[model samples]
Target chain A: MKLTRRMFIQGAAAVTALMAAPRALLAWPEKAFKAGSSDEVMQALFGSADVTESGSVVLNAPDIAENGRVVPISVSSSLDGVENISVIVVENPSPLAASFDLGPGASAAVSTRIKMGKTSNVIAVVKADGKLYSAQKEVKVTIGGCGG
Target chain B: MASDIRIKAKLTGDTAEVKTLMKHDMETGTRKDKKTGETVPAHYITEVKCELNGKLVMTANWGPAVSKNPYFAFTVKGAKAGDVLKVSWVDNKGGGSSAETTLG
Candidate 1:
């Protein structure tokens, strides 16, 4: 192919225009997330929940996280009946990501996945019978997370 | 792949405080595959166990209907400050989790 002055100018202009395109224009407010381990989040969510460890409340996660960017956690209760269920993480800039309102007939458990910016503790706090309780586990974040 | 799962415990008179955070993917089955033109098989931990010093506190099970990562918080009785508390769980694929903490 032969090069032409007019063609070169046109290509350059197109390249510049493409490079100047704004990302927000491509995907405006897609799926936003709150980053944290879990503990920092529950404390902020509960404030002061007479929180305690209960065998009736169970939380399950991995022992070693292949990636810290995405970790899974589960919280459940078997206290005859459940009033509410909530999930929180500590370490993110904004800790509280979700809060579930459980009614008299609602399930006694709520499970969800969370992104950890780094190695930190995953905390789960439960509210039952007008009282508050909590549980936590240390997620060994090996891979890069939020910043990485 | 976390090891030595542990929880924190505190005691204020008859009230026992326990905190736990497990490590697993509460995977939502709505994601797609980039290369196969199909969806990736739903994979996640589906169950958990919270024990207060060897006594069953709570047990929870979930499915793709849950969130990405999950956390649970609650309180139990019969545990005193300086005593031991144990937590464990079994996943959908038979994976197991265990953690221990001391009250106060």
Candidate 2:
């Protein structure tokens, strides 16, 4: 009876670990997210802030956002071998909003909603063929999103 | 409990567009409560993963700047109408949720 109970406990523990193994493998970039500025974020995540302005990278955002709480933003790249795309709000306290890593079978575009703390330049950074390219658009916010 | 993720997928030609909306407060941890005068703890989705027919295709890393009820959209290549698309997210507080949909 004692042996059976011990085996059951060990089985349960193994199952729990198996269930969590996948997520644990994809470790979150905590340092990049906590970086206060766009330059810092780039350094923390990509090891450099060097990015060339590119026309192939398109950043779509409103000229004036009535609601800063939910601003629609979309980014697309015509460049081949696009592996990663990141959105940055320059004026936000923490500028690195989101980053998307695309597999080979995935396209080089993404659309999402982000919060803007104030009027800021929204930048789309694309990593294609191991090189970083960026595009930026200034968005005016009537109301801030980070206020309490 | 009801699933916190809503997913929609459509196959156009050889490409499949997958869109997902996740329910999350995404508290920035900088907001103060009006009644209690205490700052709200940070609660936000930090990672999201997308799979096409059980194969990983895309991974999204998000920060607090992502708005509440995050909406994300991406496209996958070489997908069929009946293919299954799965999306899951994990929050900073260790909470997670997932949902799947068949491509139309």
Candidate 3:
């Protein structure tokens, strides 16, 4: 094989394509993460803040969080066609904690740990069949997780 | 460098429960250093993906509020034993890591 200008250009193009593939496949919602309020986050991520309170969307969390640094939370839904699940800490500096997009063959349940800045309501929002449903629980934090 | 992920996938009935623990600082950028009195820069995983046998089953987008050393668990239907399950993540600083496990 011999090196040529055309080969160099072709190689550069391939490298650029390779680097661009992941960004195109998975787009991180930077605006939503920077949103200070839950409503703003909802608007940035889903384009709406209208969420119906539903019992079918279950949010499991501790009643009193002794340490706000690592509060465990789990969200599960009995509704069919559950497409997305998000956890929001209402009192955090930026409320949107985590968001999970469920695909086909994936269950409508997820568990994770989050940091809470203060005692506040933890909202679990589920998107099923293009409709948004939510459930909230208040967790009291003795110590804040933000700073001293 | 050593891998930054620990994963386990177990098959129960017809579903495979996949759990992953990622090693990260998850700094919220709001916290100030106690000694320096300066705000620490935010460093956290922004995206996580789970694939079963080369097909994506789940994707998660995280904010700075996620705890340090995040633990995440989910289930995949129709996953059987010996299926390859891969969990990977990318952080805000362009750092990324991945780990794979077989459902057993």
For B1-104, candidate 1 gives per-residue lDDT tens digits of 44635465567775565566666664444345666767655555555556555665555443332334445554565556776667675554567777777777
Candidate 3 segments exceeding 4 Å error:
A1-25
TM-score of each: 0.42, 0.89, 0.89
Full candidate order by DockQ, most accurate first: 3, 2, 1
Model 2 agreement with the true structure over B1-104: per-residue lDDT tens digits = 23789887878998988888899999999999999999999999999999988998999999999999999999999898888888988898889988888887
Give the whole-model CA lDDT for all candidates, comma-separated.
Answer: 0.57, 0.92, 0.92
Query: Which stretch of 10 consecutive residues in model 1 chain A shows the poorest summed lDDT?
Result: A26-35
Per-residue lDDT of A24-140 in model 3, one digit per residue for the tens?
Answer: 767888788889889998998889999999999999999999999999999999999999999999888889999999999899999999999899999999999988999999999
TM-score of chain A of each: 0.63, 0.83, 0.84
lDDT score, candidate 2, position B42: 93
DockQ in order:
0.07, 0.72, 0.74
Q: Model 2 chain B: which ten-residue window has the lowest total lDDT?
A: B1-10
